[model samples]
Target: MARPTFRELTAQALSSVEHGYDLLAPKFDHTPYRTPDRVLNATVRVLRPYGPFGTGLDLCCGTGAGARVLRAVCRKRMTGLDFSAGMLDRARSAAPDGTWVRGNALALPFAPGSFDLVVSFGAHGHFLPRERPRLFAAVRTALRPGGRFAFPLAAPARPGTPAYWSLLAFDTAMRVRNAVWRPPFVMYYRTWPLTDVRRELRAAGFGVTLHPLSELGVRPDGSPRCRLVLATRLPEHSG
Candidate 1:
């Protein structure tokens, strides 16, 4: 796949989240925004002990990166859901064996206790911090007791570092762009901090655990560069 041109990206940046993804769907894999294979592979390695699940879902499964990971860990059905039709079309074509559905993440179009494993990749930035509770509640409702909701989160860059400034600049620019733009694109690099995310998951009826992805390497500070958040849904009577 060829990379999207600057004009194409500019157009996408100006469009609504769904429309922007639809426009970028064809060449999304060629971009750095796509989840890298190492991340997917490492996720598979970590999930193997917890899975071989009956059914799996890839929430916000842009172009099927996470769905492909499910294929390795899940024994039965594999489904991918995204709000963008164009992205779903590409995902369906690339992985025809899996099912693809178009729906909003906030209100997933699945029955309660429908899946045993759910994974998402590179789609968290599309959601606002306030919207996380509703989003996580929906995921919890869709999962059976003991089912898991998993996603990767990287360590925050240290303050005053070049990487830190770069992220701060990108988020600041996005805030400015959204202030002037309609149907704001909600992509913020610094929003999904691990502490807040774990608290929200616990409140959403999940027992949260962090598994270090050492294959991705560690920071100079000796912390893993990335960790997979495994939030298992608890039974109704359990906390």
Candidate 2:
């Protein structure tokens, strides 16, 4: 499918994030915003040793990209949750076998320990830094004792590189646009640094670890190009 036109993007941008996603739902898979299959596949590879999980929750499961990973790893059930009704509508169709729920990530509707694993992809930019605590805590709460919450994180673009400048410019534009606009769109490419995210996850009581995704290849510096953040909830009887 062709990308959303300039008019479509403009309209989406001017509206609230939920409504914007609602408008973009149909074309989301074709857009760069959708999580890539390679990223999803790499994450699945990284999570395999940790899983054979009983049930899984795909937090912010827009278009169900992460559902593929959950379906591959989870034994009992897979659920896709998102705040955008339209996105959930698409995800329901995309991953027909999975349960789809419409609700905010920060305010999960499910009971505590509802899932054995929780995974999210390509949705962090939608959340502000201040929201991480609530989001992480909610995910932690949603997991069963000793359950895992994991997501992929790539190294940030190096300074002075085209990718770096592009992200900087994009974030700057978003900040300016939000300052002048109402119902601000909250996406930012550079907001999720691994250090900050690890701190937030730790604060939320997750025993966090990083799994290097070798399948995704290595960086020029020999580091894995992407790493999966594996944050595990403590078992009830653990010290």
Go through the candidates in order and give each one's C-alpha lDDT. Answer: 0.94, 0.90
Kindly list the per-residue Cα lDDT of model 1 for residues 80-136, writing each as its tens digit.
Answer: 999999999999999999999999999999999999999999988889999999999
The ten-residue window of minimal lDDT in model 2 covers 230-239
Per-candidate TM-score against the hidden true structure: 0.98, 0.96
Q: After superposition, how far is residue 33 of candidate 2 from its true place, in Å?
A: 1.2
Error of 1 at 68 (Å): 1.8
Candidate 2, residue 181: lDDT: 96
lDDT of 2 by residue, 1-239 (tens): 78899999999999999999999999999898888889888888888888799999999998899988998899998998998999999998877899999998999999999999999998889999999999998998899989999999888888998999999999999999999999899999888899999988887888899988887888789998789999999764431
- Model 2 Cα displacement at 174 (Å)? 0.2
Number of backbone-clashing residue pairs for each candidate, in the order shown = 0, 0
Q: Which ten residues in a row have the lowest lDDT in candidate 1?
A: 62-71
